[model samples]
Target: MKNKLPLYLLLFFLIIVNAFFLYNYLGAGDQGGPKDQIRPGDFLVKELGLDATQQAAFRTLGREHHRKMRGLLDDIKELKDALFKGLSDDPSHQVNVDSIVHLIGEKEAAKDLEVFRHFKKVQALCNAKQKEKFAKIIEDGLRVGGRDQGPRGARPEGERGPRSKGFEDNRPPRPNGPNANRPPPAARE
Candidate 1:
């Protein structure tokens, strides 16, 4: 009976542990999970306060844009694959790398145009106040570091980030006084 008591207690403890694991794994998702993540389109719709008709139109536009972008991206991938495949082919085989690269660039340009057209259509659905807000949103998105810094997330105007080793200015420091541009004495000799 003493040995049985330990076995029963062990079984009970195991059951409690399993229950806690199951509760955390299955229950945490209901509170905050992937399902709660805000998609870009949903963010736009919510931000713009799109009405039922506007939301429907926006969704349709989004679907069409996604379909077109997918096709363009697939085409770009194929071109890139061909470009890399050329590297493995016989040396004598002709592979016009430039043409393949140009095609990829064209496809990318088409994607940009498609996105521009999609946004324009979306703008057509907005009221005046919403349009202003939309413009501000687009401007914010286009800004470097998204409204905080300069191009490529560079430090603001006067401030500089730490310089990486080996990339430091290789040129000799400029002479600060009267002989700044004068050649060195050895060079003059």
Candidate 2:
């Protein structure tokens, strides 16, 4: 009877602990933040605190900007495909690579200018308070997306250091001394 009593108490304690853990696990589990069905325009409308009139303007601007940007983006993708296709073929086929790169740059620049103009239109709809909030929101977005940074591998203005001539992939530094290009003794032997 004594042994049975101890076993029953142990079982009860285990059950209580298990229940506590199970309750906590279920309670602390993530509830997905927002509905998955929210569209970007919906997010912008809500986050930007747009009124009915502003929302209409925003939707119009977004639609036009998306259409223009989509065409430019498609052009850029086509140019990239051409560039890579040439690269994959004989090196001689890459003679037009420079032109393709230039076209891509032009398209990208146009896309950027279009986005800037679209945002300006959006900003025009904002009141003073909303404008201030909008600026902060834009700043936060640039910071988050790292769009404010210079091009990759480009030094910031006023900073002058020797630019790397080419990519170095885990290679030993090139020796500049008299023995730089001499064959090793083992190779000579």
Which candidate number has the best lDDT? Answer: 1
Report how far off residue 173 is in candidate 1 (Å).
Answer: 4.4
Position 69, candidate 2: lDDT: 90
Candidate 1: worst 10 consecutive residues by lDDT?
Answer: 153-162
Off by over 4 Å in 2: 1-37, 147-189
- lDDT per residue (tens digit) for residues 76-123 in model 2: 999999888786676775558878898999999999999899889888
Instruction: Residues 121-179, candidate 1: write the lDDT tens digits.
Output: 99999999999999998888888435655346333433334664554466464444345
TM-score of each: 0.63, 0.57
Q: Total clashes, candidate 1?
A: 0
Structure candidate 1, residue pairs in collision:
none
